[model samples]
Target: MSAAADPAAATGPRALAHPGREEIRIEDVLHALADPVRLRIVRRLSGAGEGQACSRFDLPVSKSTSTHHFRVLRESGVIHQIYRGTAKVSCLRQEDLDALFPGLLDSVLRAADHQARRLGEDGHVQRTDG
Candidate 1:
């Protein structure tokens, strides 16, 4: 075999990667949720118990941008992606997240909702719970 024909050289050794039980670090998850678009995506996702299709979610962004956001979510382990026919379905990694950080996702989503309400009210809301 010619030196240039070596498959190993074409594709280096496969780096160690998690199969299905991949653990997403807290920092990565937080970073993923930090973006407004991604946060909104997550909020809509967590609101529904069932997996949502890529096109079903109403995002105020272009299709390419939406696809990029979804990719980040999936890479950060905040969401799971599975091919459903020709469409891609995404759902929150609930069990994995719960096992890693209890109540983290819930609190973040609640905080986001609270913030949105505050913004909607022109930064005025009766301070009830912190």
Candidate 2:
């Protein structure tokens, strides 16, 4: 089987590249999270609190586009990706980020959640915040 087809082979250290905690830069993280799709991914990962397979997300974008978003997040150190039985699973780098930025991730997620609640998923105003 191809490497991608064999999770065992793909689980090696070189399977994916992620910046170290010290290497993660605030600007890169912010840029990665700036995209709506990537931010949505992060929000879901935050809520899951566990590794989520890439295919599990119901992203509106095409598969290639979603992959690109994931790459951006991973490269920027906002998330970590690993292969699990022929599936790429992703989890937020919450601990690393918290240690490095001290509440930066939580703040962004909270603000995003509040905005989503206020605007609804369609981006149209649903209700005004009291």
Candidate 3:
């Protein structure tokens, strides 16, 4: 059988979500992180405790892109998604991260930001105090 069709292959690194995790939308996570804008949003979100709203992030991308990024993040397990009226609130899955592997998300985001800044990318600021 093709690896995709094999249960054993399905249990590889890509299958390593939390024990009870419903399949985390891989496309969502990849699409979300694919954009420079969305990656910055995630970097900022990681510095916060939980639940940052849509308006709080200052993305240079257009509103449409912003919405798309949020949608991707929601579909991904990286962030918890919620709609509060017209505003969509997103928060890092802290408990989920701790359960899955400690410090992975924060370290990744921080390292990404640091690398981006070192390379002179403009969006790589320390997350602003909200």
Candidate 4:
């Protein structure tokens, strides 16, 4: 294993790649958001006003699987990830998404919340009244 072959040796531990706002496609965003794991990641990021580190998520999937999900989100332009110190932090590309597709992000998030409550997923308490 040569140092040149190692990306960390060249750049950093992890070289995060994210799609530019202009490159973001609705199809790509929808495709990335369709997955349960990815949706959970987005939902959490939405609630978090500030960026969250990759280590903060206690997902049911394995570490590698979690990494894959994050990659999908970043590549689709649904999220922007950066290396903050040694930790890679992520946050939703809400402003960019909104600018490109008006109300799309909020609608998807609302729909996700409604579905979660409806199906009692993710500890979302289903209401019986009203």
Top TM-score hit? 2
Error of 1 at 116 (Å): 1.3
Model 4 CA RMSD to the hidden true structure, in angstroms: 7.1
Which parts of model 1 are misplaced by more than 4 Å? Answer: 1-22, 121-130
RMSD of each: 10.0, 5.6, 10.9, 7.1
The candidate that wins on lDDT is 2
Residue pairs in steric clash, candidate 3? none
State the weakest 10-residue window (summed lDDT) of model 3: 12-21
Candidate 4 error regions (>4 Å)? 1-15, 122-130
Q: Candidate 3 local accuracy as lDDT?
A: 0.63
Between candidates 1 and 2, which one is better according to TM-score? 2
lDDT of 1: 0.75
Q: Residue 17 CA error for candidate 4 (Å)? A: 1.9
lDDT of each: 0.75, 0.86, 0.63, 0.83
- Model 4, position 71, has a per-residue lDDT of 92
lDDT of 4 by residue, 1-130 (tens): 3211235533555666666567889999999999988999999999999789999999999999999999999889898787778888888888888888999989999999888878785566676897
Q: What 10-residue stretch in candidate 4 is worst by lDDT?
A: 1-10
Query: Model 3 over residues 1-130: C-alpha lDDT tens digits?
Result: 2212235523533342221234654455556667777778888887776678889888888889888777666556666655555666677665664555566666767778677866665544555475
Superposition TM-score, candidate 3 onto the true structure: 0.64
Off by over 4 Å in 3: 1-20, 25-31, 101-103, 121-130
Ranking, TM-score, top scorer first = 2, 4, 1, 3
